[model samples]
Target: MIHTVRSGETLFSIAQRYNIDPNNLARINNITNPNEITVGQNLFIPLSRITSYQIKNGDTLYSIARANGILLNDLITANPQISNPNMLNVGDTINIPDVRKEIEINGYAIPSINQSILNDTLEYLTYLSPFSYQVNMDGSLSQLNDETLISSARNSGVAPIMVVTNISSEGGFDGEIAHKVFTDVTTKQSLINAIKSIVIDKNYSGVDIDFEYLLPEDRDNYTAFLRELKTELEGINKTLSVAVAPKNRDNMAGSLYQAHDYKAIGEIADRVIIMTYEWGYIYGEPQAISPYNQVDKVIAYAVTQIPSQKILMGMPNYAYDWVIPYVQGTSAKTLTNRQALRLAYENNATIMFDTLSKAPYFSYSDSDGREHVVWFDDALSIGSRLDIVTKYNLGGLSYWTINNFDSANWAIVSDTFRIKKVM
Candidate 1:
């Protein structure tokens, strides 16, 4: 359940009502200073399936259990108020356990991710994909220092996925490099062999191919490559997943979208992660990173071409602070969800929510007297995105990067869905 903060409500007061420790509540909600919760902010009340159902006429424990698809023994255990199992009174109320659907949660992490951050994040993830092993020009993979990540994931029972990208050393997607690997049979085979070798050598559970920005002509070739990679991974009992740009329709014209044939890749790969963020990017005018309205359109179109169960909607865990009078090429300072809150607190900014976008933003003037706009995800916005997962019946969600941990987001995630573990 989600509780909205009222004018006089404090975290301690909220905890008291829930009959839980205030510290635990703060930890789960990422409230470092228990007094910092803002009005209108949503706080997850970590109730354990405590939904109530009123007893109707002719209601019995057995009937209630059967009707709700719960075991009779469990029903009795939940309603310990009843002294006799055989007796039931009409108009009596009882607790009904809310059922949570199991779904996979994937997080992309950097090799240089903080050990403490990774440790805190693994518990809520089904698969951890380190970003990434850059795909070299000759179909070889640049070495990734992922040994520690893989080891830690194993200890935590989270599957570690090897991520390969068509990123050149110059720090951008190299379309020429992708074209070489996809069109040349020898290079393609070599690339596949390299991926398989790393998976087996590193004991990785799977591979996530994130090849971005390819020539429009390479669309079919890209899908063909994924098909080959999937076959090779399947032979070794490893999974194959792909990350594609958010495109609302097929044949979308853009370097990022054209090469990603979602329908074909969705069929070939075990999972398809639709990158739904970056609409509000570093260089662009400030806006919500993953606006609900925009994300909804992408998922709606995706389900038409790909099986909903195979799609993993992408979510951003970061926020952007854009300077006012935004220049076309000026860069926005990036902030983690936690840091965003801290900034708002420091500035005494009353965070505002855009109902249409379902995102949180605020404006503040720095000491330099320059006005700035900050847009970020909060419990409410994150909750709205989580709802999309269930709404689409999609496989699950994948965080773009998990280097930064957001406790309230995870709290809502834990409260709403069960994270399915492969191990």
Candidate 2:
């Protein structure tokens, strides 16, 4: 439980009231100076069922849970309630319950796989890319990795999805390539045949079509392609999902937004994953990564076009730390959510939450004496986003990429709701 600090409340007094160690409270809250407590700042107090665990050599929560016969989520849910689950100490005695059952937690795995990283995540969805598939001029396709990752995911009870992209080797999503494959009669047939072959050959459970940058004129063609894909997939008892740009209205402007045709896509696809996180990014102006206002706007319009149960809200697990005296063309440095918080702590900077945006940011200086502003997600920010899921009664959330696991996110999610698992 979180306790909001009041005026003149000492750490010792608060700890005594809660029956917890003052030092432990300070350390868990990342407070070096226990005497200095800010008014209105929320402090997480460890409860009886929520405690810390110390890691032993060659120890994993999976093995521990298996031996203890407790589900990983139960073990995680019983912990001291720290934001990041990945931030565990070697000798801490974490909270544990007596049981053996797994909770369903879905996560998106990008086409790029780092096995070590994948093994550490608690996601149930593994999205494989057709972009990585070798497509021949004759319209036949070749498999990559011999389906090594796909097999691994299935064995682990994670569903493998085929992710189709409109990207060309040059860079970015190419409209011409999309038009050629999606609109052109022969190419469209070839693409469909290739998709069918992959689904059958690889035993894929679903398909995620992520075609972007199509011309507005090709909107019908895009929709047509999705309808055909869905029809074929449904015949085989497989699912069809799409990744779309966040739109504020039916006629939201821009080629990216306009061509999406949310209403049409919703009718054809099983689930639509909204790409909602890039407002503050590498090439864009400095801003909140997933500002609450912007996200709400997208969700507000999306519900009107699609069924709320089929909308998967997008959440970013990273942040951008931009250097001061912003250059118009230079890129911003990317930092994980945990790294952002650690940077603030190391710099003795206070983290600020924007009331309007419902986002967390911190300003700090680097070793080179360069001032920087970081806009990232934290437990508080993530909690606010997850509220949208509950408010909209949406299907679930889809992480853009879980390559960088944030323990805080998992903790907050575990506290909020049970993740849905298809497998």
Candidate 3:
């Protein structure tokens, strides 16, 4: 439960009313100035469930819900506007209704159609990228392969989303070229044609646009493009979603943040997934992958701009381990949260959790005798972050990449809330 500070209410009074200790309340909320609570400031009130599970790669709502003996409807009611009920990606969080029950967990398979993996773990699956707008000159597009993945997803009761990225190459997204194409009128028209052709030709139910690293100057252009895209897609009863940088407010100054106008995107898209994870990342300063305190700040500011109902928080299923006595420009190595824990155990290092940051970190020396510090998420850290969704009443969450899977994260989420699925 959350309470917005009202006029003339003291922390002590509020805690007494809630029957919680004042210091406990402060600690949970990370409130430094408990005596000076401000009006309109939101505070989280701890309930019996203080944490939740984070959906990882290979997780689905159906399996998670069944494992917890939760009805699918209960999960859907918890989160509305989930366009595809059977599809879940990495970083998605499904609420676990029963913490103590042993439940089945499922995830969608991406390639080689791993039936054995699917049979073993995934209750539902989603095939990505079979439906996408292929760029063409003269405002036209050509259809790509469609039948195989769709057939696979449907056969397993999994729903599929048309994943379209601004990928000039086969592997990843290229934001620079996308900005050029979207900002140029002729190119934009051609892009639209491609989108229309793909939607019509492939019979996709929804579209997911993953455009990244866009220039700041193109903020208005990006907003305008999304608006037009939404208008076009809505006419046919199709859903539209755009991936955006996680930002606190509109005036956020970074190139990535500036181009993604949350307010504008929220108004235009059916769902706006905030790419929240990345703090502890490869090529980044060693830190917690998604520090709870940092994420809270972003969410706090985001709620002010976009409606909580339209926001889908982003989660990271990966972690990073950095060698210490660091060079000025050296990068950290990417590690799974599970791997991070194993490393700590293997190296005989003690794992420590940060109260203020709500992250986990440990220090150790590598075989080469180089000192290192590793920070990452665990069941505890992931649970703490998921709590923000319920406290803030967010729409849902999205994952960065679901290639790696984690079991403990799923267990915690399955215990707290039901995973919502789209009908």
Candidate 4:
């Protein structure tokens, strides 16, 4: 079990709510100053079904266990720290362990989602990151009515990570805008200040910086910005997560993929979310959204740079349908994972998985005699990808967007792994 701090909640109050000792709570989470916890911070309870119970003035291990419907032996075993239960301090916190390790699950959400969707999906997330707060050159941010998502996530025991991106409201990621903020000292500080203000005002547990298509010249500047933000957020116990495009090599050159400097980012940010998807994209050739071979290669190189424990492999929750005889400038249409399956069924298309890519894809001709190819991830493919997490000892999985409810994906994910909760 984990607990997310809410407004006006202090370490003592949270400890009492969970029936844990304040000292134990603080100790487990490395809270040097128990009073310094901010709203939205995730506190790992280190317990699952069993809540921690504080020893009262007249409490005995037997009495405590009996009262909580636990066996005395189990209680004693779980609270080994209490060598002499009879002489326990009034506020001694004891663990009641029926524990199962839960993997962290981070999902990205957009502002347009309704309350119903939020309610339905919060249970499956460890963190719900809003799609973005677009940054302006002057360090200003686009406002969003994200209160609903934040409140719902907090209520559901899921931490909300505010996503700050370099994308322009008018369109996609702007390289010039990224360059301006990264290279201009004044604008960069202003952007950091703006991000900090929004984080505080929104009670965000952390910030996910997704600056893409950066100019190679701004690489050092980008690292510096992350370091500063990490230090600032660290002072207040807030987290910093950075999202980088997939690359198989450190020196791989491209505007979109370069300048990420994964090693530097991994050293600074608390989490480095590697977007391992998009081999098949809106404007790309028909292929698996995340080709296993590519993703594996990316992971192999990333682990050599960043600590595997800090990496959250990014997975695409959607698919793409591309027109055959692929034209240079033509873009493929998008679809949800379920939608892709429905299309395959309607067309009687025989699905096949590429051995090299380890992605499932198929082809069919439309009424207009136009050939199309569909590549997407289903339960089987998703499961295989998730297996890589355990294989690589990575932090967890980060879904690019969880707006569409793919029950198959969720079901398989849940069945395969338990999710950590901070409520």
Q: Name the candidate that leads on lDDT.
A: 1
TM-score of each prediction:
0.90, 0.76, 0.68, 0.76
- Clashes, model 4: 3
lDDT of 3 by residue, 1-423 (tens): 556567778889999999999987765543545674544344566556523467777767777666556677776666564678777667766555443322112232344444453342233222232434434334344354556655555555545566565655454455666776776788787777677666666566677776776788888888888888888888877888777887766787777777888877878887777778887667767777788888999999888878887777887867788888667689888887657766765676666668877877889888789999988766567778878888888876565554555555544555555555453
Q: Scored by CA lDDT, what does every candidate get? A: 0.89, 0.74, 0.66, 0.81
Per-residue lDDT tens digits of candidate 4, residues 1-423?
446556778889998888889887775554556766644344555333447987778888888888766688888888788777667788878887553235788999987876676687788899999888998878788887799888888989999999998888787898788888877888888888888888888899999999999888888888988998898898777999999999999889899877899889989988899999887789877778898888999999999999998999998988899999899899999888667766765786666667777667778899999999988875557767887887888888898788877665665667557888865
Give per-residue lDDT, candidate 3, residue 259.
84
Model 1 TM-score, all chains together: 0.90
Model 1 lDDT tens row, 1-423 = 667777788899999999989999888877889888776566777765547888888888898888877788888888899999898888888988656778999999998899999999999999999889998888998998999999999999999999999999999999999999998888888899999999999999999989899999999888888887888888999998899999999978889899888888878888999999999999999999999999999999999989999999999989999999899989999999888877877887777889999998988999999999999888789989889998989999999899988998888988788999889
Judge candidate 3 at residue 49 and give its lDDT. 58
Judge candidate 4 at residue 283 and give its lDDT: 86
Worst 10 residues of 3 by lDDT: 100-109
Candidate 2 Cα outliers beyond 4 Å, as residue runs: 1-106, 111-113, 123-146
In terms of TM-score, which candidate is stronger, 1 or 4?
A: 1
Candidate with the greatest TM-score versus the true structure: 1
Decreasing TM-score order of the candidates: 1, 2, 4, 3
For candidate 1, list the clashing residue pairs, or say none. none
Off by over 4 Å in 4: 1-101
lDDT of 2 at 191: 82
**RMSD to the hidden true structure, all candidates:** 4.0, 11.0, 15.2, 14.3
